[model samples]
Target chain A: MEAGGRLTEDALIARYFAPLAGAGADALRDDAATLTPSPGHDLVLTADAIVAGVHYFPEDPPASIARKALGVNLSDLAAKGALPRGFLLTLALPPDWTEAWLEGLADGLREASEAFGCPLLGGDTVRAAGPALLGITALGEVPAGRMVRRPTAQAGDRICVTGTIGDAALGLALRLTPEAPWAVALTEAERAHLLDRYLHPRPRLALAPALRRFASAAMDVSDGLVGDLAKMLRGAGRGAGVSLAAIPLSPAAASAVAAAPGLLDTAFTGGDDYEILCTVPPGQLDAFRGEALEAGIAVAVIGSVEAEAGAPVFSTEDGAPRAFASGSFSHF
Target chain B: MEAGGRLTEDALIARYFAPLAGAGADALRDDAATLTPSPGHDLVLTADAIVAGVHYFPEDPPASIARKALGVNLSDLAAKGALPRGFLLTLALPPDWTEAWLEGLADGLREASEAFGCPLLGGDTVRAAGPALLGITALGEVPAGRMVRRPTAQAGDRICVTGTIGDAALGLALRLTPEAPWAVALTEAERAHLLDRYLHPRPRLALAPALRRFASAAMDVSDGLVGDLAKMLRGAGRGAGVSLAAIPLSPAAASAVAAAPGLLDTAFTGGDDYEILCTVPPGQLDAFRGEALEAGIAVAVIGSVEAEAGAPVFSTEDGAPRAFASGSFSHF
Candidate 1:
């Protein structure tokens, strides 16, 4: 609005962002948003930030990038069995930001916020150097003293995961190394599936109620399943013996790994999976599975907690030891 | 630690940040932090993001940057009459980051979290492209329906501000142009005063209780005195005629402006002045001033709401209308 080719800060917020605000945001005119929690509910808070060309490609669709910023944080809440309440966004735009790109981002946020039941509260935007970054802080609600935690698994709990693992990692590999045998051997449908997995995260929020009622310990499987599970178990002062052969995989992922077997490591070690990895007590496993099924989410039983206080064990169906337990270490 | 030169993400968090965790953070080992608000309170939330080489010098002390990331957001909470509850951090480190730098940042956060009574609840860290970014989402609490808002000022209200206005702006001017006449004319104490104001923010949290009781409308003067004041006035559907002579200035700022009269514009229109600008009804002005004195914070009355609705007026001591009213515009 100032005619210097850059939108004034107030005008930018009013034009592009103010419409996305939800209840208690005061239409983003106030310095802060006021949220009155329902009686007997506790707030669950989580924050995640993504950088252009680091977490997502600079050329990726603007809308998907916006969604991912909120989606990843929502996934953390889902893992904790908290229903999405609202989210705050902090974005730094490079000098060359386009109005169309901003519109697309707002469109994406509008759709995702509506779909996830999380509305936009309030946020701040600033001008920065290159490689723009977007951060989100999502708040959720759970009944008092009822949030499932990461380090509460017992020795007899069953290890379960929602949805398949390794698809996003395999998809990332396909995007980065098209000439590789695994990438080249895929059919159009398989390629589409893998790339879609890499681009979009379907956070299993539908199963939050079931997870809250049934799970002993849980976490989002963003960093490889082996490493995340091992970390969770280690925190609980216990360990688990998981069968690598039993790890769930999508049809497209199965086909790609079948074409080039070494990608099995990539599938088990790469990040951005965003699936829910949870533990259920042996007595609650059946009910958890039944509830997950009724919620239209898949749950797989792959292992059991060991009664020992040592590092976790990953093995093949033949009971041979595998060594990728800390393979995700490279990511950190 | 892992075998690689890079600290594993988990180890980095555990070593440097876990000790700062407050209640319900689960020692930073959980998916999310659970916050149970006190009964009959509304949570006020605000988010602010700062980028290296943009917000502060790339060589600025790491701890200060960490503090500013949280400090600016806390200033917003103070303006809304919210008391500190807790905060979430989202940080991205450039590939060349060092452990020493990370430790300094953690140390700063620890001190600030303790000093403000705002604890580190939980956070996420990731490796990213160059030019690191830090974001803080701070949550505070206020008695229900009692938050001070920016657009609630009524006609005939007396506009007031806490602390001096132009020190941070003049300090920034000296930092960016030490050879300027104003910078060169300043004494060592004056220069130090300016630099400190620019480098750190003293959020006026002590005045929040009085503000909740007295202010009709409130907001943080972050952009600049004139522009920010005009913006606040316009938001409330009112206008004000403010006297430039009535604006409070530190002795250092007074000396700098005397040396180079033109820098007066910079003093009035520069960014990062984190003082509170509030409006009080005529009847409550004396009580508000008395309470502010009891709290040991300075309060200055600079202007009065105008009867007619139009762009606010800024005037010099000679009663001639001066026009730097929208001068902070270039910042956006």
Candidate 2:
């Protein structure tokens, strides 16, 4: 067709995508992919999109963008207490794409796909007149009737989070800042840690099994802990009291916050954390923590759910409520 | 959250998407959705995307855009001999999006989702600085190991296509022509017929069961019959010889072709013909045709597979090979 159109498209798939195709993908030749499920398991589905300029800098590395695209959807599956299975990718590329760019992207996708156990299925690639967009729909599996939900938190359940928070937010701030102030104050290792967390978030997939076994309610802390916890509380028709002093933070984030108290607001309101925020019953907190530790993940009890329904209260060590100028990061 | 960002997003989902969510969507409150697969079946996954100004006209109706986004993916499932199940949608909206536009889009998606038995599972909505984009990953189910493939056509297989092939190509030609001469020559009903074909393609899902039972190789004619047939043949490691006279054409398309013989190339090479192109064995031809008729679909045996592996040849009534300037319409 159109001189080299058909040949180009066929060759592109064969070269870049064929290697990523799983057993059900038919080497990317069939119109669709076939995924046979484990008889008694249920499939968890989630879709997410990242557009150029909105989600990442145009100058961002293609590999990082590719990993982020798949990682975001994987985070959703982890929050749902499902194990990553496979995914479909839709790439809307601009006219200026190059062979090197494509190779970089493929390399990144291959790495993430292998790391997460989510092989590529069938997808469409089309040219766009505007900025490029990367979209992915990830599929996961869990035992029947066992998916962790966000609206099942009960009164007296302890609010818990995995890993650390605010590193990504502070990292993004550092990345965007011109002649960054943290550059001189923080050690080189700490700066790199924050930047790495911002560019490549490690979704708490290791905690999914434990969450399914013990968590009363669960959601990924994407749009800041303050806002996401508020959403979970609102959905459960309950309230939460989070202790600012108990919130887990990376050593780098703590140093930045200590250096400039104003940075604390950025940590609380900025998003892109990608850490798991879950509620476990008081009786099961010890068990959940032990299991999480066994899985090589740090778990911390940050708050408790209350029967009274209202905005989540963030209390300081002095028992005074801390207020944020903004609740969560919103692209709009 | 930025003033109305989160609130607007919540309102949009509540107003337009909540009604379309299936049983496992959890009223769209959870980050992901759960789908229980039917026992003894494999899930067929397909994904497609459409961007403004590339796949459709900027001024086209929002409802039509929505249908095309989902319709393209449905055609993939049909070609694979699968039944519609559920889908996840990701939308990247421009700042100018309005409630009215969203309502129209939702109406179209809802209508198609119901008609195809593909319900909304879960999705993400995000803001973009560029043109809007819509992507969908459709899920379908078929009996284990029963999916129709493209690499099974034998040497003696009869190449058949459903419905008419050239209507959509001709319809698109008429649409792109400003102050068109054909408009005055064709009747109002005929003109509308051609326009409707271009705007909304009917995926041949009704004939899927027959295709699975009788067809040896199959694929939907998205990138024109000649090119797509060549693809099937390439996958099967075979070649084909088609008779140009045997190609089916609608009354409107027949009239247009009669008026301008040169339009034949456009009819043969233009893409967006969502009809099914399949190859049936000689022994199963009768059964396939009978079943297709019962399903109220037109089936035409316009070609035959050859032993040689090469580009497909299109022969005229005089037995002379006819050539097209291009094989298929390619966006690249």
Candidate 3:
């Protein structure tokens, strides 16, 4: 907690993480946790890592870093139509990290765990000589043979997305340039809304049940809508024709795009949207919409799956196909 | 492939990790993997992370680094008396990392996965601005409600350990000081044996079934015998009296200790000895030994559990209680 001296690994774990360990975690003392599978449920596995300076700024709060680390993994489970059960965290911290930072991170993780019904089962904490790297392996359970896969979308299926797209990407843009000429035209509340979307992702766990029942193929859009949709299409050996104008955009993002038409490419191609991109059969569209609305979520039909085997194509309102400066974000 | 230009994240994953993915991995294109549990089996979950400078030297072989990353997690599953299932990997790589290094790492991971019967399920790869960090979440399966735990050790149990102790510690010492007067006397084979023990740990998965049937408590010794045994005792509300002379040591380690008598403290306190440390009933000692022998593993009884709530005490051949120079390796 106090860096190297006076705070041993055992004491640090006991003080910061032992209390967060839920049932089956053995109070963070055991080598592994025992988790009984619910009868007739299959397990879903997803692992994600977020690094300081790469995923978030070094000036970002520790709580946001922790939330984003777990939130990204949770988003994967939600896309897979699985209910969150538990997770294991592997944290690599620098020597300069402080006890107060760990406390903030634990507080954020605890809040997310309780809110999402996913508890911290077990984890490893190691000292790093580099920037902090936080990883989470989240486990979820879905009924046997019920997981929504990315390779099962059928031709003619209606492609839909939850919440809004491009908000987080625009929010990131705003964060990097709050005083830019285009950004200064926006209201302070609009700026905050965009920034909030970037910092905190709301994984659609509430929609998993609905998605399980209605979606033919689904995935979380973390790497931009155009690129992630292309991945899903490639996996399914199918293609799609999406309407860029139909894609839902937050009011703040819409305002930004209105101020600078060139920002549309950034809105469509930037990553970290954390929204579900799924194909729903036409027959289930009404039911899916009703269920999502009942759950206080917004759903939009953005496109239709084409019979051709190719990448998704985004077209403008005038039927001209749009080309992004970059298809999606990639680390390498 | 280049670090950040021609070798994209997708291409890097395809080149290095796609072939390592086992059944239900969905070719690593999907955001998450689906796994159906075998009937009557519960999951044993464990995670561990190792950083470049903290756990291994930056110049260590990529293959050994990969093995250590996965081996440490597998060791946890072995300690829980579970069969290896599958694992998720999260890797943070620096900009200077090379394709050849990843190739070697993938080769090592593939071999270990095949040897341990634990395949890759899915993973996330991201770029970092600092030293590499690798995290693994290894899962296993045990019969429902039958996971071996450290807190189940009985007072009258005989504390047994698998294989030789202190070899890895000695190996580390030799690595740090090959030209030292104490290390210069070792034969080439002896030095290789110690170095191999430190670089590639053989997780005692073969002993899991025997432990499940015979042991009262079990855990992998990664943080040295002195501290880890104390941890087991504290967990079980018991104590142990271990005879240092009775603790099994490799021929190479024994010779090293003979050369430098002060290395005994290092042997007892240094970490990275990934062996199964367990407690068996005195009555089942013979049967446990036989089963372990049949499985091609050596078992040694080095201590006895005592009916007291305290730390473990190590005694020399003359019955003098030994004191360690350091309790255990702590990164914080």
lDDT of 1 at A211: 91
Which 10 residues in a row give candidate 2 chain B its minimum summed lDDT?
B1-10
The sequence of per-residue lDDT tens digits that candidate 1 reaches over residues B72-144 is 8889999999999999888888878999999999998898888888999987886766678888999999999
Q: What's the candidate order when arranged by decreasing lDDT? A: 3, 2, 1
* Per-residue lDDT of candidate 3, residues B71-93 (tens digit): 98899899899998899999998
lDDT of each candidate versus the true structure: 0.86, 0.87, 0.88
Residue B164 shift from truth in candidate 1, angstroms = 0.3
**Could you tell me how far off, in angstroms, the CA of residue B304 lies in candidate 3 after the best superposition?**
0.9
* Chain A vs native chain A, TM-score per candidate: 0.97, 0.97, 0.97
lDDT for model 2, please. Answer: 0.87
Query: What is the model-wide C-alpha lDDT for candidate 3?
Result: 0.88
Model 2 Cα lDDT, one tens digit per residue, B244-289: 9999988888888887788788887887889999999999999999
True contacts kept of each: 0.79, 0.82, 0.88
User: By DockQ thresholds, what CAPRI class is model 3?
Assistant: medium
Clashing pairs in 2: A1-B328
Tens digit per residue, CA lDDT, model 1, A1-332:
77767678788889888988989997888879988778999999998888888788888898999888888889999999999999999888877889899889888888889899999899888777767788889999999988889999899899999889999898888889988877888899999988888888888898889999999999998888877887898888998888888899999999988998878888888888899999998999999999999999999998999888776788888899888734572443
Q: What would the DockQ be for model 3?
A: 0.80
